[model samples]
Target: MPTFADPFQQHQAEQLLQPVLIRVVDNLRKAMEASNWIGTYEEHLLWPEGTTTAEQEQVRQIAAQLEDADPEAAQHLQEQLSHLPMPFPGYELRLSQGEHTQRIDVWNLCYQVCFTHYDPDTPAEVDPHLLDEVGDVDWLALDEKAQQLVQVAFEQLGEGRKD
Candidate 1:
């Protein structure tokens, strides 16, 4: 571990880890995609994240009402829930470089990624070149790729069925 005596030292350390950072995130995503993390939906998911208890209770109440008032709509809601794809889980990152491979815990990798992006309260800006790669990185190109991946998740996932 390199101890930064000052901001300049920190900048150099950041530069040193830039390529590793990019490679980790990229390789992790690639490995996960190859492992079918996105295509397979878990049968256990009912309500996705951000669903409040109150909302769930309200749903239960509505479901009861629907059972008495209109059984058809209740069945439709149940069917929809059953068909819904599971929300993306905190997945493992399997990075393979030739004969070397690293299996990073999802939580720890998230922490590393987040820690890299952390901005201290000091005046040091650090440029925030997130996911730095070898040599100079084309950030604009990355932005486009990011947009496309987001769209794939949104389009393929379909926002959890707005219908």
Candidate 2:
């Protein structure tokens, strides 16, 4: 959301931000793919994002109480789960492709798409090189694109819109 000094810098920032955005989108897509979010069960709450042993146990505990809730429904049943300890505990996706490793929160990204008031500070967290080059980004536009990508992913996975 930063301004650029010139049109060229603006273009460069846009170019540089593309992969970061894709990575962020992929973080969500991959998390969805990493596990089966169906069936209202405790085991369903477990995902690849939480790697630590403590985190795994936390999910196990959260799963036990969700006798009638699903992992996918967490966004909807927040009030139900609020009193219980969090399952994500920090839904940080550790992306290690090639030489660099970065952590992103797919859970937060999903929320941010719906509630835009949250700080879009991820660009800076990934790398200042990206933050320095970024121009004012149309986050709503990017969020829409992310939604499209999620739809495509669901299609590829043969997931249906269940109410």
In terms of lDDT, the best-performing candidate is 2
Candidate 2 residue-wise lDDT, 1-163, digit = tens: 3334467644655554555446556645554555343311111243344357765565565556555667666554555445444542334445443453444444455433322243444332222223333444455455555565455444444433333
How far out, in Å, is residue 92 in model 1? 12
Deviation from truth (RMSD, Å), model 1: 16.1
Ten contiguous residues minimizing lDDT sum, candidate 2: 35-44
Model 2 residue 97 CA deviation (Å) reads 2.1
Task: For model 2, state the Cα shift of residue 121 in Å.
Answer: 14
lDDT of 2 at 91: 46
Q: What are the lDDT scores of the predictions, listed in order?
A: 0.44, 0.46
Give the range of the ten consecutive residues with the poorest summed lDDT in model 1.
Answer: 36-45
Q: For every candidate structure, what is the RMSD over all alpha carbons to the true structure, in angstroms?
A: 16.1, 14.9
